[model samples]
Target: MLADSSSSLAHGHKGRTGLVRILFATRHSLAGLRAAYTGENAFRQEIWAASVMLPLALWLGQGWVEKALLMGAVLLVLIVELLNSAIEATVDRVSMELHELSKRAKDLASAAVFLSLVLCGGVWLAALWHRFVPG
Candidate 1:
């Protein structure tokens, strides 16, 4: 029943509706996590950092909003890193040659990751200051 454009956008998953689509998506997502954890050293390091920060966020945050903000920031770093890795991988897959566009794409993705880390650090510092420093 989909239009031509909609059908083309399905990416061959037209038959996978409802529960089937959800299950397939979950499986693919888990596979991505596994691949990122195993293959990307930065991702592994971020996972380790998140393991520590998540528990600390619970203790340091006095309320739900603080806790969520702290936790979300940490997660944002991981999300950005994953995206960066994916972009790099795709660029590399296209060609290993030293192309300007490839370099720019990788650089842009790296900047995104850097920005996410800065955001995470700022959020955590603000939380710590709010908790410990007298205003």
Candidate 2:
């Protein structure tokens, strides 16, 4: 009974360990990125934006802290998008038949992504304004 309970806690297979777990985790992380890039158009779009903004952030930023903040803001958007995608995937996986709770979850996730985008935009604008605009 203890063994059964432990296995259940591990969510089946008793979980991975040591180097094997590290390798598995890396692979799973890459797969999640690939799936989000391929399946989620918004994620793909954000990736493209990040590709541009990340380098620009470095070039435009005056100091290490500024650059880090710029990069972090962009990364936050990506992180939120991934989480939103995961939420959407989980909701869909549970059932395709229209349901209110599923809609609520998905909508909330989407709103999170939108807010992340807004935050990213605000950060970039502030950085650019600080650099280019005379104060």
Candidate 3:
């Protein structure tokens, strides 16, 4: 009876250790996934856009500089979008109410996103024109 009780206690300790290990692994995995998702949206969208534009830019861009600028514009838009998201998140965390300052801040962040998108479009058009049919 004594030996059996001692073995049971050791078994219980092992069980506890295993549970802790599993929990730690799960936590790390979740944190990694959250981080990946945070950046994944921008990366996925930009890559999709590139899939459409890479060939066109390669053919239509005036030179390496033009190609670089076109790609860089897309990256810049993504950066701005991420920043805008961060701003909205921060505002929401600060307060969920309909405050004037929160509204203004979100609106401003949205405007910045729009401006970056517009710049991206303008760069693409310019690069395409310069590459396909220069002035």
- TM-score, candidate number 1: 0.90
Q: Write the per-residue lDDT of candidate 2 for residues 1-135, one digit (tens) a residue.
A: 256767665784437788888888899899999999999999999999999999999998899998999999999999999999999988989899899999999999999999988998898999989999998
- In model 2, the runs with Cα more than 4 Å from the true position are 1-5, 8-14
Tens digits of per-residue lDDT for model 3, 9-121: 67664345676868877887667546645565754576578677767666666779887887778777767776777788789898999999999999998898799889989
State the lDDT of candidate 1 residue by residue for 1-135, as single tens digits.
537866765776656778888999999999999999999999999999999999999999989999999999999999999999999999999999999999999999999999999999999999999999998
Ten residues in sequence with the least summed lDDT for candidate 2: 5-14
Global lDDT scores for all candidate models: 0.96, 0.91, 0.75
Error of 3 at 130 (Å): 1.9
Q: Which model, 2 or 3, shows the larger lDDT? A: 2
lDDT of 1 at 84: 98
Between prediction 1 and prediction 3, which has the larger TM-score?
A: 1
Sort by TM-score, top down from the best: 1, 2, 3
The parts of candidate 3 lying over 4 Å away from their true place are: 1-47, 54-56
Q: Model 2: how far is 77 from its true place, Å?
A: 0.7
Clashes of each: 0, 0, 1
Indicate the residue-level lDDT of 103 in model 2.
93
